[model samples]
Target: MELKGFSTKCIHGGEEGKYEFDVIPPIHLSSTYQLKYEDQDFVYSRVDNPTRRVLEDKMSVLEKGVASLAFSSGIAAISTVVLSFVKPGEEVILSEDIYGGTKTLFMEILSKRGIKYKYVDTRYADRLEDEISDDTRLVMIESPSNPMMRITDIEKVSKIAHEHGLKVAVDNTFASPYLQNPIELGADITIHSATKYLGGHSDIIAGTATFKTMEDYELVKLHRTRLGGVLSPFDSYLLLRSIKTLEVRMERHCKNAMEIAEYLSNHPKVEDVLYPFLKSFPQYDLARSQMRLGGGMISFKLYTDDQDKVDVFLNSLSIMKKAVSLGGVETLIEQPATMTHRALPDEEKKRLGITPGLIRLSVGIENVEDLISDLENALRNI
Candidate 1:
C-alpha cells in the first residue's frame, strides 16, 4: 500500500507482511543463507541482509528516492559514493562550509588516490558554474551546513551541475528526511548520517545514501559489497525502530530549536545566531523554500573574544551536555573550532567561519523553558 503521510510511511514503509502475526519486523542475523536455487533472494550479509534491506527501503521512501543503501558509518557511505562515481583525475566541487570530516576525507585520503576536489561557496548557486571545469564530475553540498548553518539552493545548484554533466550529492543529515528531501529538490543522490536523527538516540553509528535511479543504486551497492561497509543486522534493526518516531521527534526538536534560536538571537552576548528559520539569517527565505522546518541544529557566535569566557560558558551548562555529535534526546553543545573542526588548519577554519567564539548546539526534545534557562545560566557565566 502506498503511504501519503510522513509518519505513516515511517511506521510502515518497508513492511511487506512477511509475518502475519507479528507486528514488528524480525531481525535476520544469519551471516549466510543456504543457496537452494539458481537465483535466491537471500544472500551473504556483506552483499545483502534482510534487516538492512528493510531499513534501506524505509529510507528510500522517506527521502523520496528510487533506492537506498545502508553503510557501517557516515564516512563509509560518503567515501563509497565518491569512490564509486568520481574516478581519478575527476574533480568534485564541495561546499566550503562543510563537515570537517568530509573535508579531511576528500582532501587527505581521496586526494592521495589522484581524486581532485574544490571548495566553493555553493550558497551562491550562480557562482558555481564558474568553478565547473571539464574534469568536474560531481558536486557535493551540505545545506544548513555543519556549525555555520549555511543553506544552499539545492534545486538551483543541481540544475547548474546537471547542465555541466555533473551529478549533485547532498548531505541531508542535518535536515533529516522529516525536514528535507534532496532528491525531490533535483539532487541525484541524498546522503544521511543515520547515526544522528535517523537513529535518534546516538546508539548506532550508521549511514545511508539514497539514489534517484536504480542504476546509481546498483553502482553504489556493488562498491558497498566489495568494500564491505554494510550495516550490521542489529544496528539496522535499531535504526528501523528509531525511524518510526522520527516525525514526532523532529517536531519537538524543531519547536525547542526555534525557541532557543530566538532566545540566542536576542541575547546581548550572542553576536550572531545561525538557525535556518531565524529571520536574521542571511538565507532564511531560501531555507524556508527548501526545508520543512528550521531543524534542531543551531550555531551562534559569542560577543566576547575571550577564550576563557567561552570555555566557562560551555562548562557552566548543566542541562545541555558539552559534547560532540548531534541529534539526540539530550541537547549537545560544542565549539567547532576546538572540537569538530580542530583538525582543519587555522586559515581554513577562519575562512569557513569556525571562529573560537562560535558555538554549535544540537537542540533536543527537552522542555523549552528548561533549555532556555540552561542557556541563560550558561550565558550569565560568560
Candidate 2:
C-alpha cells in the first residue's frame, strides 16, 4: 500500500514499515555497516545511512521530486546544487531579496571559483528573461522571499527559463512543502532550510535538495558526497520525527500568521504589513495560485524610523524570542538591519526594502489571542 495524502505522507512517506518493523524508524548510529560482500546494502556513514535514507525518501515525496539529498546545512545544499552545474566563468540569476547568507555564498565563495551570479527582481517573471545570458546555468529564487514576503510566479519563471535552456531552483524554505511544492510548478530543483518548518523546532540545523530527474539527483549527490556535506544519522532521525507533524504544525503557523498580519495592518504603530494572504499585498493572487497556504512569515515596517524604537519593541516582547532563523513552534522576531542581513550594505538593504523600521516575524503555533496581546503590548510600548 502507498500513501497519497499529504498528512499520510508526513507519517509514512519513507521506508517506514519496510525495515525493522518498528512503528518509527530507529537511529542507525553505526558508522560502518557489516559488509561481507561488495554487494552489501550500506558500507560507510558518509556515503549513506539507514536513518538518512528514510529522510531523503520522505523529502522526495514532500517536495514532489524524483529524489532527494540531505545536507549538513541549508548553505551546503545550495552550494552543492549550484556548483553541480555552474562552472568557472558561468553565471546564474538569483533573487534580489534572497537571504543574506546566500548573497555571501555568491560573492565570497562562487566568485573565487570564477562562477558569477546576477541578482534580479524575480517577483516579476518577465524581467528574468532580460537578465539571462548564454553563460547562465541556473535561475534561483526564494518565493515569499526572505523576510520580504515577495511572491514569484514559479510556472511563468520556470517556463521562460526552460525556453532559454536554464534550470530553475527554488529555495522553498519560507513556504515549506506544506504550503508549496516547487517541483509541481515546474522548478527543476527545490531546496529547503529544514532547520525551519521541516524540523518544527530550533534544535536541528539541516538542509534538503529535491531534484526533478535522476540525472540531476545523481549529479548533486555526487557533489554533496565529494564535498562531504551529508547530514548526520542523529540529526536525520530528528528531521524524520519532525516531518510527521509538519501538516498539523503548518496549520497552526498559517492560522497564527494570518491573524497577526491582520492585527498589524490596522495597528497605529505599523506603517506597512507584508503577508501573502493579505489582500492588500500586491502579489496576493500570484501567491494563492502557487501556494496552498500563505505561510507563517510576516514583515512590516513600524510608523517610526528611529532605530532606538526597535530595541524598545524587541525588548518588550515577552513571548516572541529575538532570533535569526525562523519557522519554529515558538515565534521569532528579528530586525534584519542588525541581524541576518547586516552583512548587506545600507544602500542595498534599503533597495531591497529591508528598512530600518522593518521587523520580520516568524509566527509560531502559540495561542492566537496570546500572540496578539504580545504584539499589542510591544507596539504600544514602542
Residue pairs in clash, model 2: none
Stretches of candidate 1 off by over 4 Å are none
Candidate 2, residue 43: lDDT: 91
What number of clashing residue pairs does each candidate have, in the order they appear?
0, 0
TM-score of 1: 0.99
Poorest stretch of ten by lDDT in candidate 1? 16-25
Give per-residue lDDT, candidate 1, residue 80: 97
lDDT of each: 0.93, 0.92
Question: RMSD in Å for candidate 1, one decimal?
Answer: 0.9
Estimate the overall C-alpha local distance difference test score of candidate 1: 0.93
What is the TM-score of each predicted model, taking all chains together? 0.99, 0.98
TM accuracy, model 2: 0.98
